[model samples]
Target: MLRWRPWLPPLLPLLSLLTLLVLSDLTSSSPTAAPTETGAGWSPPAPVNHLTCYFCENVENNYICNRFAIDHPCPAGTTFCRTLHIMDTRGGSVVVNKHCATEDQCRDDRVGCLQQDHQKTCVSCCHSSYCNEPVPTNYSNAVRQPKPTAPTRAVKSAGAAAAPRLLLLLAAAASRLLLLLAAAASRQLLSGSRQL
Candidate 1:
């Protein structure tokens, strides 16, 4: 009665049709409609990790932090034309980022490159060389020997270049002395001859 009361006000025509159909056979009736389900969704893929040089763990974001926008979709003609986005972080915000067409350009730790008109790029974060850090195996006077210490910042000596200037001045002074002695000897000899 509650359901009929709300609908009865506006559903007069449908109600009249059911009343007319009451005279029809009760056994034979139209089937009810079925409902449909849309199962349309996708699961997100896991993020991958990139290994790089020890010194270059951090990557800078683009001019804008963390956000990178690209207009070109690749492979209009070939499979090799696929382009991938690279996420890089800088500061608290992500600033540095680049895109690359090949795995060689984007993922290769040894080699970094940029493609597609500088719109995309890859960079190196190469691991530290074996000798950069000390290893225990080389201890206790081992035959293999320990790695040498990395050179530190030192002021270069300018002593070498300054030495030559002193030598040049000494040579000039020696030549001047020889000339003065020759002049004195010549003058003395001439004066003695004239007096005689």
Candidate 2:
């Protein structure tokens, strides 16, 4: 037989495993359960989708590190601010030449503080709003209104102006006819009296 002593080291791991199995069966009728619920330490999988941040491209290779003053500042985890901008009002829409650290880039839009119409008309228009709000944002919210439309063309009525003249002319004609009738009646009455 080969030397059993020489094989002892190589077979030691196998022997220990077998010994454990035999002892486990003898000690308990059923295997003991984990101290905690099964799979207690496991966690849910990661999210499937994630939004990426935009970078400012207003200027050449300008990296967007901060948020613009408009809209919501760089979204919490936004990586960059793009050179996106819109006119808050009509006098002149803001143009974002420089990239903002935040998503919206504007100190205060030139036309911002005031309400305006598509024609670039301000709330200060005559017969409308008297350019009241010192600060527009809060004021606009308080009085939300629709944009004003263009004025319609009006035509003048010719008869309306000639009314007084027409009345004067009719009065003159009536008076002349009445005077002639009165004179004729008076003549007839005088003649009759003389004959009597």
Q: Estimate the TM-score of every prediction.
A: 0.24, 0.24
Each model's backbone clash number? 12, 10
lDDT of 2 by residue, 83-122 (tens): 3322344333332222113222222232233334542211
Model 2 spans with C-alpha error above 4 angstroms: 1-157
Error of 1 at 5 (Å): 99
Model 1: which ten-residue window has the lowest total lDDT?
A: 130-139
Model 2 gets an lDDT of 0.35
TM-score attained by model 1: 0.24
For model 2 the TM-score comes to: 0.24
lDDT of 1 by residue, 1-196 (tens): 0111333334445544553444232323443433434435443343333211111112343333223333333322211111112432321322243232333332334233334442433333212121111111111211222223344212223565565566556555655654555455556656767999
Residue 31, candidate 1: Cα error in Å is 99
Clashing pairs in 2: 54-80, 66-101, 66-102, 67-101, 67-102, 67-103, 68-102, 68-103, 68-104, 124-131
